[model samples]
Target: GEEVAQTPKHLVRGEGQKAKLYCAPIKGHSYVFWYQQVLKNEFKFLISFQNENVFDETGMPKERFSAKCLPNSPCSLEIQATKLEDSAVYFCASSQLGPTSIGYTFGSGTRLTVV
Candidate 1:
């Protein structure tokens, strides 16, 4: 089984502050993805990277949210001017053979709380 490593199990930020999350994809995985879960039934895809290049980011917000997955470095997701509504769990995932070939793994996630 594959595994993605996410750091900072929990984050607490004041309103208007910034929050950042870090993720390490599985050793052999080339595709990395970030998802936001604001509600139990909602999983919003934030961004995806194929190696160091961005693959799909249609679900990403035009501003305030950004992500990067670079070669030889941990991937990161950052949110600027955090709002109370931004409080949620951010999950990092990776697939060894792209999203379609299975072998996908999701990290436990970093729970963010905006106060």
Candidate 2:
């Protein structure tokens, strides 16, 4: 079976620092998506990339958040100047659905803690 891979299942960062999380979508999948889940909250879309191009990213935060999908490398999400409120579980998912549709297969997630 195929799976999405995520690193550092748990991360602890101090306020004002940075946190970088990694995710590898299943092979053969053409689209990758990132999501954020704050304590007991619904998963929030962060960004999406189809192949090497960004498909949609309307949900990304304006400050301190950035994401990328590099060739042959796992997609990454970096949060600079982390804040206590940034504590959350970040998830990565992948799909092959065409435009006009939203579908996904999810990873367990990377938990982030800012103190």
**Residue 30, model 1: Cα distance from true site in angstroms:** 0.2
Please give the RMSD to the true structure for each candidate, in Å: 1.3, 1.6
lDDT of 1 by residue, 4-99 (tens): 899899999999998999999989889999999999889999889999899999988858999988788999999999989999999999997876
Give each model a TM-score. Answer: 0.94, 0.92
Which pairs of residues collide in model 2?
none
Q: Candidate 2 lDDT (Cα, whole model)?
A: 0.89
lDDT for each residue of candidate 2 in 56-78, tens digit (9 for 90 to 100): 98998868899999889999999
Worst 10 residues of 2 by lDDT: 96-105
Off by over 4 Å in 1: none
Among all candidates shown, the one with the greatest TM-score = 1
* Model 1 whole-model lDDT (C-alpha atoms): 0.91
